[model samples]
Target: MTTSTQPQAQAKRDEHTQPQAQLAVFDMAGTTIDERDEVYRVLRESAEREGARFSDEEFQKWMGTEKHWAIRNLLTIGGVEATDELVDKAFAWFRDELARTYTANPPSPMPRIEESFAALRAAGIRVGLTTGFSRDIADLILESMGWTVGGGEECTIDVSVCGDEIPSGRPAPDMINKVMEITGVDDPAAVISVGDTEVDVESAQAAGAFSVGVLTGHLTKEAFAAKNADAVLELAADVVNLPQVAAQ
Candidate 1:
């Protein structure tokens, strides 16, 4: 069965009390990379191969979550018996397909996202990438994009946190917490988390960081507004224009 949307108290997005972010964390697919439908394409093919079905809404419910978690949800929604072995096998299949497709036609970063990265670095703010993809796939995308990771102080991304690295994914605050720990950012309020899904906003809010919803990703303008992101931007480039970001 699909998971219920359990309500939780969301941390307030108080502008006056919010501190400028020292580090900015961005999601990979949709938010940073233009692999919007490509991800779902692989997902659909893999699910069909495994006899699972997914409508748009069904697929959307797993947005911003780990690939394995999404696979399990898809299996449950498709009425396929979700066995541990089946889930594992299905996840492996999905990963293989995704890696093959990504290898053939690697996605490019979204428009002005690179600009935002450069601008953030120029202003002495660190940048990190968080993704629902596991380390291997995340690394594959980074390598394909020619982006560097890992360094004492200077690297293209400074650091990256993958979904598999944490116990849980978006809406749990784990991935953001991992990023904060890796980057040594003490105050969660001094961080900005950007993603393209409702869970992304929730994750940021739960982590006590500035939440930014970009329009280029999984969420539409109206959907983003409904999620109550601290700020909504037409694209990633517009993030630099936010007061919280600008003051950084």
Candidate 2:
């Protein structure tokens, strides 16, 4: 593989410039996609369907983890041995249910997503999406939104990184790292990542990016700040309009 020149180019760009964000990465479900809490419901349904007795709290504990990982954890918690076959079966069930339900209802942007996209574009920042959903489902949501990245909108998504695309998902830095790589913004300091979960905040923080948490989804106020989010907003779109963004 060829070594990327992004770092060198970024260094040259930064030499005479104040460090500023060049890209923004946002999460999908609960972050920007309004699924109305159906995801967790489906997770629990999948667990139960596979004969695993995962309670709501137990299932929520694994939020933002890869589906297979979450399924194995649920299986183990419910005293079902997590053999490869069993884990695959449970994850498959969850994925199928998610696809079916979402296909029927599709997904809409969370409140303020359009405003956020507008702000990002006005500031000349590129945008990307990182999500725990697999690529197929993420694509499904994107198509439904008519907001497919790099197409279908004036304020387009430059990249979309789904959980299965990387070695691991949130709480790990891989997704954020991948965004930086593909966007040609080598410095995490020049990136802003916003999401509605602790895993989202944690991933950006671990990657050394500015982590913003939004409360438009499953989290409460104190719970958001507890994630050590660099900033907390009522909506993800408010992030690009922050005073710091203007400086960039």
**What do the candidate models score in CA lDDT, each in turn?**
0.80, 0.76
Q: Which digits, one per residue and each the tens of the lDDT, describe model 2 over residues 92-136?
A: 878888989998998788777877776776677878899888888
Q: Give the lDDT of residue 23 in candidate 1.
A: 86
- Candidate 1, residues 1-248, lDDT tens digits: the string is 01123324464476556777688899888888897568877776666678887788878878878888888888888879889899899889889989999998999988878778878877877888998899999999999988887643445777899989877787778888888888788887788888888888888877777888988866887787777777777776677776766876
lDDT of 2: 0.76
Location of the lowest summed lDDT over 10 successive residues in candidate 2: 4-13
Cα error of candidate 1 at position 52, Å:
1.8
Checking candidate 2 for backbone clashes, the offending pairs are: none
Each model's TM-score, in the order given?
A: 0.91, 0.87
Clashing pairs in 1: none
The alpha-carbon deviation from the true structure for residue 93 of candidate 1, after best TM-score superposition, in angstroms, is 1.1
